[model samples]
Target: MSNPNYDQILVHIIDYVYHTPITSPRAYQRAHIALLDSLGCAVETLAHSAEARAFIGPVVPGTTVPNGFRLPGTLFELDPVKGAFDLGALIRYLDHNDAYPGAEWGHPSDNLGAIIAVADWLSRSQAKDVTMETVLTSQIKAYEIQGIFQMKNAFNKRGLDHTILVKVASTAVIAHLMDLTEDQALSALSHAWQDGHPLRTFRQAPNAGPRKGWAAGDACTRAVHLCLMAKAGQPGAPSVLTTPRWGFYDALFGGEEFMLPRPYGSFVMEYGFFKLVAAEGHGISAIQAAVELAKKLQEAGEKVSDIEKVTIRTQKAGKTIIDKTGPLRNPADRDHCMQYMVAVTLLKGEFIEGEDYADDSPWASDARVDELREKMVVIEDEQFTKDYHDQKVRSGANAIKIELKTGSEVPEVVVEFPIGHPKHPETLGLVKEKFRVNMQKGGFESATVEKMIEMVEKDDLPIHKFINLFAKEVPLKT
Candidate 1:
């Protein structure tokens, strides 16, 4: 008989992923769109900074594995471990992938690092067809695993970064992707639980830095490593989560047990929101409110100098994650700051972009941004907080109220969901635009971009063909 002491959480996840049948056509279509969206994010991030490329590719030059995993936006074919880091970091570099908000906030698409790496590697090394259909099914499963755990667990509250879920979720799905046995899957997941969790300090004040951008990638790399070890016959930690005083729950989760709101399925990818603008997820609605207020200011023939004070009301998650004061350190710092996002939108009277947060960008050093940050006040709206946590609503609500020098207040503009939410049918066009623009930004030719759109739009494209299209390398400048 199987050991009765195996961690139930790991067992349940493995069984669901292995046993569940994806019967919903809507789920498959959503996953396909998400794959395209995430690849767009990866391509765009390639131009963010050369620093990102340092962590990708083979550990040494000219050490390529035959039929190895191909990274998107480059020609490097590497072992799955390094490939996961490359793809994961690229997808998350700009924080532009899909997000699902609840008790915890995370980019569920971050798992694409491991999902794509292992799937591509398997297709090339093994004889599996690995169609786009297979990739979509795996993507949906990974998103569900991560999103469901996020629904009820407040990892940030315990001072741990939310990417812990990335490691766990990726490990489960990647093990399945490699076709590991149930015991090997169990061992792989057990190792993920034991891996040290990253502190959220890099994501917070006075110390915020670029690590936040690549932390998910690091988690993805580790998840792949664990899966490989398990396949090599590593022993499973049967009680990793429930061990007395040392388990994940007691040690890292503040002694509270995990609360899974529902059984695992395709619900998360079905409802996940893509970012129309490349900013922190919590601050998107606030950015929208600010943009509306800016339009109103323009119509009233008002200048940004006419603004006396700015008040922002948002969900508690927003206040916890993005609220910041004092000197903004870098692009990472600026992007995560609520006041900075609002200031740029109100001052420029346009939607913010990833380049806007660059350290050398004029906006980063603009005195007016600091001026607005000083005049801003952020508070939590109890109802917005409640609605954000409500399963049915799950709205990332925020309201912006600006006061003029004339002692008159601009009408408070509130947004329950940002433009990218699935509820807004109009955003489909915008997401398509974002994909095209990002592809060009990543240095692909216009014809290549058109071909990518054509190929991805087709329902019967094979996964290996899609991967090969992305494998075409851009010529590096001498």
Candidate 2:
């Protein structure tokens, strides 16, 4: 029997994976940076987050797969599926990885969890000859796939988390990495579409918690699992996206078809934002604005205690996602809450760090933090909202004004772009510095950290050898 016609979306993804060749030198350069940056973020998570560390081992302790992938920054060797979860969770736990803001905001680097796991596993077990070059190419393609989908699709508005894109993007690239035929790749992608996606509630107030940290890991795990199933001869639901009432469009997307505003390429990687400061993508600018205001206060010998009221102006997406005015339950909650981040930064007179959001951190329990939060008002700026979604000008703008108790008002501080934005002059240097700091914190020697950075630039470095550099046996805290 002839095969059924697949949806254009599925066909486009499969074709891109098989046919697109990454020719952009800039994309590869950024991918190299992204790879190291993601690993550094993972190391940072291992160093600071006990909750993230608790989830790092295999499903069953002491169970090991021969020729399993080695998880960076730890000695755990596991099959690609579990490795994907550990790596994904570690890279994303702190919300410090790179982010792409759009109709649907996400971290494209999240797909690196699946890409690195599969490539390392294949090279070790099957001797597939996957190299750093291969990994970079895959990273570019995955970023393109996820980033393009995010450009015009508003999945969050439909109450779905953005990790659905991570799953689909990872599935496509893993199929190519495993040398699956086009038909098999289509099958894998169909399964990704058919899988139930997590709700956005875990990222919102009153429900925000640690699950937000590992949702990408869960998506990467599912992606690798679906690819394995497809490799084992699973059949695909050809029209999973468009098959009437039961299709993804009708069932989950409210009958709106997914949009691809641009063709598949390296645009996402080149233009992605790195989180130099550990906060939600939408609130990075707000945090920067708060920091600027805090600096002004410090220069004038003003204390945070003197501020009677704070007003934050942000984009609509920011208000929709991180403008929370309630009790933040954990690090995940605090990082996503604009008021909490701003209050913490203003209190410290510096940029917010990952630890500041931790439940055990003093800031979480500080009455001053909550008091400041209570006094703040978050309002949406129409132009900021427009610029945030505009294809030609994607800006995460936030303005802050402080009203002092002495009956004085500080001029509004506006930060249109946070550090690590592509347009920022210091982005590359700061990103490299962040990686160095995170690597050393994860137990790498300063010399070795420098060596690893240099090694990632080599195109022909074997995948397993590259992963081995991060395989230190750091003991987990009980």
Strongest candidate by TM-score: 2
Q: Across residues 1-478, which tens digit of lDDT does each residue of candidate 2 receive?
A: 1233888889888888888888988888888888999999999999998888887888999988899999998888999999999899999999999999898899999998999999999998965999899999999999999999988898999999999999999999999999888899999999999998999999987888899899999999999999999999999999999999999999999999887888888899889998899999888988888888988998899999999999999998899988888778778788989999999999998998999988789999999999999999999999999998887888889999999999999899998888988888898889999999999888789988988999999899888988888988764542
Task: Name the candidate that leads on lDDT.
Answer: 2
* Model 1 C-alpha lDDT per residue in residues 136-247, reported as the tens digit of each score: 8888899999999999988999989999999999998888888788888889998998988999999998889989989989999999999999999998999999898999
- Candidate 1 has an lDDT of 0.87
Model 2 residue runs over 4 Å out of place are 1-4, 475-478
Q: How many backbone clashes does candidate 2 have?
A: 0
Q: After superposition, how far is residue 415 of candidate 2 from its true place, in Å?
A: 0.6
TM-score of each: 0.96, 0.98
- lDDT assessment of candidate 2: 0.91
Location of the lowest summed lDDT over 10 successive residues in candidate 2: 1-10
Considering summed lDDT, which 10 consecutive residues are worst modelled in model 1? 469-478
